[model samples]
Target: MPPKLPPHTADALFFCPSCSTWRRSFTNTNTTNLLRRAHQRRRPASTLAASSHPSPASPTVNGARNVPERFRELYAALQGVRDVAANHVNMSRLQLALRGLEGEKGIVRVAVLGLDNTATTARLVRLLLADPLSEKAEWEDYLQTYRMESSRGLLIRYGEQTNLAVGNSLVPTISIPSRALKTGNLEILVSSLGARSISADQTIASDALLVPTIAIQSTSTGAHSFVRYPVHKSMVCGKGVNGLLAYTGLVGRVNPNTADSIRAAFELNVGEGATPEGNDGISFVDIERAETALDMFRESVQNATEYEKGWTGSGVQPLVDWISSPAKDVAIDPAIKRLVDSTLDGAEKSIVSEEKRKVLALEANTVPEEVRMALHETVSAWAERAHTELRDSLDQGFASKPWRTLAWWKLFWHVDDVGMITSRILRRKWLPEAEKEVVWMGGKIHQAGLLNQETNSTNPIQNSTEFEISEEKSSTFSRNLWPTQIPDTRKQLTTSSVPSLHRFAQNLVMFSLSTTSLSSALSALVYVSTSTTSVYEAGTIATIGLFYSLRRQQKQWDAARGFWEREVREEGRQALKETENVLRSVIHEGGRGIETAPETEARQQIDRARQALSNVK
Candidate 1:
């Protein structure tokens, strides 16, 4: 500035003393302006416009974009989660409903109880439902399908068989496919054969009173009087009089006198005032009359040319009319509806209560703990018993003269009595005892309701013929004492390689001792015959060698005895241990199959499901 120098020269000469401060200020301002211009030039026009007009929805460097589209996406995700939760709730309710209805297919179960003679009952059931036009083959097939044996009761459902014998009781439930049952209607039929009272057949008849049903007493005309008893309200009102059917089969003849006797018996047993609430009482039908009338009707229909002329009058028209009167569609009786509703409610409440109990049980580890401890105790007791048996067998083997014999000749050729005894005890006594215990345990588990259908179908010990012993790492014997094959009493004892090796070693020791003794005797004879000092010294040396050989043989014998005892003990112990482990595993797996989740989680889920079901109901 002093000499008015060119601008470039002034800027470059900022070190000049006179206007130095001013030059410095000018240089800093000029540098900042140039940087600002370059930054402005680098920025896009859109960025500049956005910065000038700054919308609230625009994205910022440090914050998310406050856009409506993002909000919409978040709301959609929340709605989806809500929908999924609702669907899960709905599905749970549906499952509960289906279970209450018995199954998804809604199968109707009709229990047929009473009657001590199953064959007569079967024949009666066939008479009730059998078609008149059915062929002989069909009747035979039906009889076979519904055949009830003393060992097992049969369940006939749509011509399929299911054995209902749980243990000793027969729970014969006959299933009929009907849409009416899907609407919560149930029918039970109780039948009494001959003059036998229903109360006499307490096994199935007493159980039938719990369900809603109708009683049908099939009596012979020869019976003088009928027995009368109080009937349960659940059974009587379940289907009303329309459902009850009493059949009097013709024993001798189907005359007026027989009908009068049947009528008198019906009046004595199930009179008009016999029902609880004065409802039209039980209907009685003469089987012989009905059968004859049905046959005539069938014949008339078969030979019909015109309906007006084909109509025939049957003497049992009143009975037929009474039976057919209830066939028309009628609303369920209020009492019956209330009964069904109450039953359903009771069942649901029971299910919920049972689930709650199960949750508590799971939390307390009650079932698993009880089953595990019981099974463990059983296995332990069995093991202890087996150990005692093994010890006894060992003692017996040792007490036997053959096992303790040190005779060189016998030792060289004789079988290992100890090993053979051990094998025999393991094969016969121990294995059979184990199988028996296993079978008993399985039965107990089944009785305790711990076993399911799949597990209970076959015996648990059916395939457990072979027992293996694990080799001990610390055993001094070179051979392992484990069985390589299933125990067979028929097989030769030499099949066991370990026992054979032990016998060979024992024979070798005896052989050594025998050779040493013979050598010593020959040396003494030679020394006496020669009469030399060197020969006498050689005989003395041979005598000393013989003594040492005898001592070595004694030591080997003791060692062999110890080894055999130890091996047998170890094998027995290992066998017991393995058996216990197997039992424990079986029990654990069975318990685990029925194991529930954690208490809190299960309770919460059950509560939610129950709430959903209640809401739907």
Candidate 2:
């Protein structure tokens, strides 16, 4: 029986199922475990210490030794930009620029972009400073990052609206319409109908919580700074009308295609193989750990046998047969034999039919057909090599050498481990998830151009029985964030006004409900039925009595006059509201500060940071 394989190596192999799977690797070779561990004659500890540190001549920053050539170049480019002062002015300048460039395709104006942008930005800065690797580096890292994504924007609503109420201000609003998304103003109407001399009907709805992501293009083409925030709803209502208003918004899921487009742009600006952008504050030790892991992985792949790797489907069985043939002469331990058999069995199981095998062959087109067909031979050769090496080492007849004899199992374990580690390292190396959150230069703006298109214009006219007036076609929006619906303009609003009589003699109605007038009129008609003179006499007396009765009720008329005054006051109130439409706003009057910090202070910090970085090691 072959003695147990090295426990460390054995455990590593089974621990990583990905190593055997190699789901995203370029090759599917199973020869990684083919090598016998290099025999180490004793090496002095002093030599290991000498290799631990880098020479002075080597380029590095903040103690990151043996820096990649690419990073050196990147570091140079980063240092070259004289942007401290300009960058400091950038925050204020950008806010103005964004507001001024309204109506541009894909342009967005965030009075305040999102709820979480500033908080997240501050946290990110702290993280960058905490990274020990950049301990001695200049403040450039912090300042640049702070500007890059710091969203100190105030608050705003998503979509569009006609009115925003801020304190005593009533902002006039314009309609913003899309299919499933529609913005409505809080409609309030004053009335004086019957007992209600000054009544108000208000219909207010809760603001739909929305998350806003803003990607601002920088001076460089395609380069962008992106920020996101949750929207806070602020509107006046019943008890809350006089209180503070706040809205809730959620971060939207990025569309799949949009994510891909964004990733391409980020890679364009950030360079390939750099650590993901979000992890800018990690220590050099962590970076070194990653680099070491990568080196180990590359070496494992490099050590595999070339022949074992190229098994096209046609050659797989032959390789399998050859590998197991070692069972004939080597007298493998029953346990080891079963281990080999089961792993092989799994491979066969993965390709149950010929069709699947051919598909795999086509995918690995670089491997030659001859090598593919010789898979069986390759596996058998591996077994034979392990046996021969072990037998020869044993013949040396010094102390026993079990390593060469156990090389085959070690090879299996290594192969499995490399796959799992490779997947992890590769994913970290080519991170694509962060792309969705950032916008890059030259990124697609088709989805962001919604503001450039017009949506259905809904005019809320009073006294209308329908909900919509007319359907007007608008531009299409991305389905990921907005749903499309057929435009229907038949909608309308209904008004509740009291019936009135026209004042013109020809148009006015002579009808009156006064009891004395009605009684007099009926008596006159009966008197006229008997004689014209009697009817005339009775009509004159009835007219005089009617006038007297009206005169006696002057106190009642005075009371009714109060109701008319109320109706007039309601009209004036409505007119004033219309006049204040331009000044209405959603937030308190004091919430509109564009830049929270003084310009001088920001610029001073920028310069100070630049100077500090200049002095960094």
Alpha carbon lDDT of residue 414, candidate 1?
Answer: 50
Residue 309 error for model 2, in Å? 60
1-617 per-residue lDDT for model 2 (tens digits): 11333444333322111010111111334433222111011111111222244442332332333333323332222222213223312222222221111111111211211122232322222221222222222232332233223221221122233222211101111111111111111111100001111123321111111123333232224343333321111111111111111110011222221111111001011222332322211111122222233334344655223312221211222211211222233322222222222222222232243335555543343233343234324333433443443334323321223222212223323323322332232223211222121122002222222122332123232343322222221111222221111011001000111111011111111222254677687767768676656766777767776665544433333333244334423432332232122111110111111222233433344344334333323
lDDT of each: 0.37, 0.25
Worst 10 residues of 2 by lDDT: 486-495
Q: Give me the runs in candidate 1 sitting further than 4 Å from their true place.
A: 1-74, 82-377, 406-410, 413-435, 446-497, 500-507, 510-542, 594-617
Tens-place lDDT digits, model 1, residues 162-194 = 223222111233344322222433232333332
At residue 285, what lDDT does model 1 achieve? 28
lDDT of 1: 0.37
Q: Candidate 1: minimum summed lDDT over ten consecutive residues — where? A: 15-24
Report how far off residue 242 is in candidate 1 (Å).
27
**How far off is residue 500 in model 1, in Å?**
5.4
TM-score of 1: 0.33
